[model samples]
Each structure stands twice: as C-alpha cells, then as structure tokens.
Target: MKKIVLTSFALVGLLISTSCGNNKKEAEKVEVEKEQVTPTETESTEKETSESSTIVAIAAANENFTTLVAAVKAADLVETLNSAGPFTVFAPLNDAFGKLPEGTLDGLLKPESKETLTSILTYHVVSGEFKAADVVKAINDNNGSFVITTVQGGNLTASLDGDSVILTDSKGNKSKVVLTDVDASNGVIHAIDTVVMP
Candidate 1:
C-alpha cells in the first residue's frame, strides 16, 4: 500500500513538471519570434519609404509627366527633357489643366499648333536646376523680385512675399507655387497651381 501511494505521488509530480516545461518553452519561443520579426518589419518600412521616393522621381520624369506627357510627346520634347542636362521644371498638376479654358488643351494638341505648344511647354522649363531657396534668394536680392529666362527664351518673373512665391509671365499671366521641393535624381519639381502660357 505504501509503495503504491509513493508511485502515485511521483506520477503527479512528473505530469506537473512536464506541463511547466511545455509552458516555459512556448513562452521562450514567442519571445524569440518577436525579436526575429521586429527588425524585418523596421527594414520593410524603410524600404517602402525609399521605393516611394523613387516612384515619385520616376513619375516626375518628363516622359511620365501626367499633364505634360501628351504635350511633351506632341511637341517631340521628350528627348530634350530626358537629356543629360539637368532641368528644373515648374510642373503643373492635372487640376491645373482643368483651369484652362475649354478646348485649350485640345487645340494645343493639334499638329498645326505644335510650335505654340512647344514654346508654352518649354517656358515651364529652365536650363539648370533652381531650387526654391535659390529662387527666394534671387527674388530678395533683386528688390523682392527676380526674373528667370526660360529655355524657350520667354521671361518669368517671380516675387517672394512672406511664405508665398508668386510668378508672372511675359504674357501678364500670374501663377502661384502650391507645392515645392519634389526631389528627383536628375532635378527637382515645383508644383504650380496654374500653367503659365508663353
């Protein structure tokens, strides 16, 4: 009888010990998994941000420009825009296109109006890189204003007041810089609210 009781107690002890061992192993495994996964998640986030910047650069590239794509191709300015020489383009968003009068975009797309289209598009481009800071400095040094010569030989004058950058074209058209400092490998882009016609 005594031997049987001892065996029963030993069996219970063994079962309890086995259960505790399993629990400890499971807890350790969970901690190890979390540690292993943490760095991967952080790296993934960094990779995504890097990829987003690249996509922005590619999309801002002249060939893939949203509003300017058709016009660039129509005017055969793709090669010029994609060349090695860096350029700072005052890019107009699609909504800026909507601001134009009806039939304006269509009229420009016609083959007969190629010269006009090219000039207008080129007016948005400068020969070299000009960041917002440079523009602001030039404007301040020139009595609150500075004039830039476009690649098309047209003139674009800008004024800096407070935090806003205001632009005026040779045709007496005015535009506002809505967004700025979109970086690219080749150059940079400043998103303007209006399209300045040459």
Candidate 2:
C-alpha cells in the first residue's frame, strides 16, 4: 500500500510539471508574436498620417515653403486653407517671396495690412482643386490661354510658356509654375516662382 501511494504522488508531480512547461512555452510564443506585429502597426499609422495631411500641413512639412507658411499664418488663413472642399493653391517658395521689392513682405505682415495681405493671399487660391493636367487641358481648350477666377474675386490668366504653366496676375505680373500636383487631403498645390498679387 505504501509503495502504491508513493507511486501515485510521483505521477501527479510529473503531470503538473509537464502542464506548467506547456503553459510557459505558449506564453513565450504569444510574446514573440506581439513583438513582430508592433513595427507593422507603427508603419501603417505613419503612412496614414502622411496620406491624410491637409495642404497647410503638407506645406509646413516642407523646408522650401518656410516663408509661405509664415505668410499664411500672418494672413490668418490657416484654418480656411486647411478646410475641406478641394481648393487649388498656387504656392510660392521662399525664393519667390525674396524676389519681392525691399520691405514688401514686411509691410504686408503688419497688423494694419491684414486686409491687403488677405486679398493677395486669396488671389493665389481657387475654389476647386485643379491639377496640373486639368490646368493644361483648360489652357488647350481655351486656345492657348485659360482665365481662372481667384477666390479674392480677381482673374488670373494661365498660359503655356514652352511646356511650363505661366500665371498672369491682376496687376499684370507674371509667375511660372515650377512644380505641380502636390496632393493634399483638402486640396492640391502648384508651386510658383513668383507671388501673384491681386
């Protein structure tokens, strides 16, 4: 009887040890799977952020548009440009702002010049999203020149100048679109070489 009891206890101990070992192995496998999945989830999140960024966010992320970003903020148009409805923005680079006559940019940023600044900034924007291909098509359909109405209630003439899209502002100043079709969640931006004033 004593021998039988000892054998039974030993068997029970062996079974418990095996069960614990299996549970530990399962726990380790679950941890490994979680580790592998983390990076993929992070990558997906980053891609979504990039794809959903608005026009202002896209411009803010680029280094070339520092001046443009500043001007947008100064003009109090950050929210308007960030909203939905698919606007077409003619963005000017820092170099374009630099080409302005001395004190022009500084003067525009002044508090009293807010209305004037807003008008000038709005002149670069259109109501609907027009891609480069669409603009080209419009120009061709219009017999080499297409007139686009600005959000500020002025007209800009778009023409092709040797494969480049040129914009003639209300003041008769001209700007060349250097880069086109910068996609944004709210709109698209075409970078111009000069600021087209209203």
What is the C-alpha local distance difference test score of candidate 1? 0.81
Model 1 clash pairs are none
Candidate 2, which segments miss by more than 4 Å at Cα?
Answer: 1-52
lDDT of each: 0.81, 0.93
Model 1 lDDT per residue over 1-198, tens place = 999999999999999999999999999999999999999999999766554444234554544257677777789886676655477888777777778999999999999999999999889988888889999989989998899999999899999757989889887888888877777545667888789988
Pick out the ten consecutive residues of candidate 2 with the lowest summed lDDT. Answer: 46-55
How would you encode candidate 2's per-residue C-alpha lDDT over 1-198 as one tens digit per residue? 999999999999999999999999999999999999999999999766845598889999999999989889999999898777589999999999999999999999988998999999999999999999999999999999999999999999999999999999988999999999998987899999999988
Best by lDDT: 2
